[model samples]
Target: MIRDYSQRLVVQEVAPRDGLQIEQKWVETDDKIALIDNLSACGFTRIEAGSFVSPKAIPALRDGDEVFHRIGRRPGVIYVALIPNVKGAERALAAHADELNLVMSASETHNRANMRMSCEQSLAGFGDIVRLVAGSGASLNATVATAFGCPFEGRIDEDRVASIVDTYREMGMQGITLADTTGMANPRQVARIVERVLGRIPAEALTLHFHNTRGLGLANVLAAYEAGARRFDASLGGLGGCPFAPGASGNICTEDLVAMCEELSIPTGIDLLKLIELSRTLPALVGHDVPGQVAKAGRNCDLHPVPAYVRTI
Candidate 1:
């Protein structure tokens, strides 16, 4: 059933921003730029390079300004930066980011802890941001963090998430990324939520962001894809997680996603082998082990024939 997608798959790399943000060690600016450069060569149309969050909150990505300024822009590759508020938006615009991603949590508890604002207040401020960036060449987007579930609040209601999405739509935003910040989603919930949200808004407007916390990240992606989700958020070497969500690993791996698409004859336009090669350099950069499976195991088509001598055993 997963192989039945008639639409082309869109994979958006979020390693530079979401992936690196949660790391304990610092990733150098040039290295981050090199990582972006590597992914750019892989035919990813949308790559989230960095974010504008404060240094105090996320010191690992403090060099966002430098990373943005240093990376050489590849033609046709959309380099997006996540912005938390107007200040972040201003910084992103100054850095010449191709797109600006704003975010707020669906649950009040998580929103207060992560963003320190109520849901209603954040939505009200989103309108102000929309007006502020009206003439900017950069595209404006808002990610609904913890749309699937929140660590602080436990299970999140679908209707509440739908309300937030409706608010985002009212802002005339072209894109909205629904994030599983705590990796609490399963296949059934993913399909149900994506189906309902996409019904209210266009499928093109919704992007699913899943964390591999419970080992259901890929399954959730499959569920959303079957429910008509086209774009997904992935990281090279599976490099990211919520600082708030304990034991949560990085995002869905880019190489694994590409391999799935390739095996299914879907047009992802990304080369998995090259992306896996790029993932090898990530461990030293982040000073930790990554969680991507395809980085360690070869694709299904990459299997070798069993030797006759081994078969005899």
Candidate 2:
């Protein structure tokens, strides 16, 4: 296997949108803007700032419009908004989102549960959205949720995924994301699928979104990286998950992923110390502890003073 770990990785921070979507306590719109603005300063080129879904669906991010309009847009950063349909796409465009992320599940059951539409219906709707966004100057990204494995259907066929990728390319999508929504993917599976997708999708245009449900998020990232995938979606403090998918947990943590890349000598261009400081405030934001480790344990290079007793001894 070609194991090239030296290539730079691009991490898309999704804390404001994916990370806060499932929270029981609503993250104030002001805090969400602050979070996105702070993350913007951390060298992320892409940040999923919010989504335009119904407030009834994800009430926490209902203020997406306000947040998008108010946040300080960094000169080089791209602010992305997740959209499920033409309406959401319109709302995103109205908010002046830099990119529109459209998501549909590979599994029929998950699609029905999450999007309230079938795969065919989702694709049909995507065509409308593509037409709507045409000439709007906002790029589009089609995310295939549960591309690796499904909670209800299990083991999505690789060919099925490739067909979806091909459709997105044909539809003129600027980017595509394969999401392990329930964290069911392993390293071997990730590498295999990434290699196949890379055959069709360029590494820069492809993004991998993994969850830490089974504690293999970073492992999968490495696998995808080794297989020539450079872009990844990670949430701050490992917050957020698929509310419709059973056993789904928060996404791979941004700080942890960056730390791993830093240790391996892969440049992510993110400020690790600033990221950790931002991660430390998540518990208060959500009113609960988070799943990310590097934030709590500190980076590997963080050193503590020698114990007073040991020094005296």
Candidate 3:
């Protein structure tokens, strides 16, 4: 299917929260704040600043409160905080998150494994969370993880994903995200599922989160885009994974996605040079190399000078 390719895409940066959450090394609160502040100035209108989960679960992001409080907020940028339940929601609200992102896996086994609760219990808790955040002026976004496939359960039913979207919509969520939690999605499957989801929610309200585990992340993004998805979640330098979901790896890279968008002439309003520079800092912060490509490959416009021998030849 031919995609418009000219449409503007919303790239939601999730590095600080999703990227750092799984890192073994602890990122200092000051560095987190500085990174976020730099991201705020990079033309990102929405960024997942941090999460309010228990520190025992994700020690790397234990300083969510301080990171959120210390970061410089730009006028048009929206700072999002990931929350698991009502307690986390309350803490995120107190930290002044512009949006609250709630997550639940579509597969029952995955949900149990990740949250230690059944799918029904997670939805029930989200209902309470929705009520608690009402009138707080913060927008609510629900992410259905393992929407494409699950490690334990294998292929997830499309109807099950639709049902989860229905539940979130009933709970009054403003946005919904379909996450390929383990990078098991193919382009054909992504297009079909995205079409199914677009039937229930508008294109603007749906976000696609993909991982590059099997090297299909960008292909799935293109498929979803053709199927009417405009928003996407990507981590800087491809630094993210599910600590609960076994075999999960880093998320789709922000710099790589931006590079794809730039190549396609799709407007994302993000500076590729600045994003590449920011991605270069991850190795120092996490004490390891990152997985993104644009940082290493450079853009197509980055021309190299010819060798003198070659020029003479």
TM-score to true structure, per model:
0.94, 0.97, 0.97
Instruction: Write down the TM-score for model 3.
Output: 0.97
Off by more than 4 A, model 1: 1-3, 244-248, 305-308, 311-313
Model 3, residue 102: what's the lDDT?
Answer: 91
Could you give candidate 2's per-residue lDDT for residues 1-313 as a string of tens digits?
5456778999999989898888899788889999999999989999999999999988988999999999999999999999989999999999999999999999999999889989999999999999999999999999999999998998999999999999999999999999999889999999999999999989999999999888899999998998899999999989886555445456999999999999999999999999999999999989988888999999888898997899677
Would you list the rank order by lDDT, best first?
A: 2, 3, 1
**For each candidate, what is the lDDT?**
0.87, 0.93, 0.91
* Candidate 1 Cα deviation (angstroms), residue 143: 1.2
Model 1 lDDT tens row, 1-313: 2357667889999999888887888777889899889889988999999999899988988989889898878899999999888888889889999998988998789898888888778877778878878898878888998898888788998898998888888888889989998889999999999999988888878899998888898889889998889999999988886566566675888888888888777789888888888888888888888888888888887788888899778
Best by lDDT: 2
Stronger candidate by lDDT (1 vs 2): 2
Error of 2 at 217 (Å): 0.4
Model 2 TM-score? 0.97
In model 1, the worst 10-residue window by lDDT is 241-250
Model 3 worst lDDT run, 10 consecutive residues: 241-250
In model 3, the Cα lDDT at residue 132 comes to 93
Candidate 2, superposed: residue stretches over 4 Å from native: 242-249
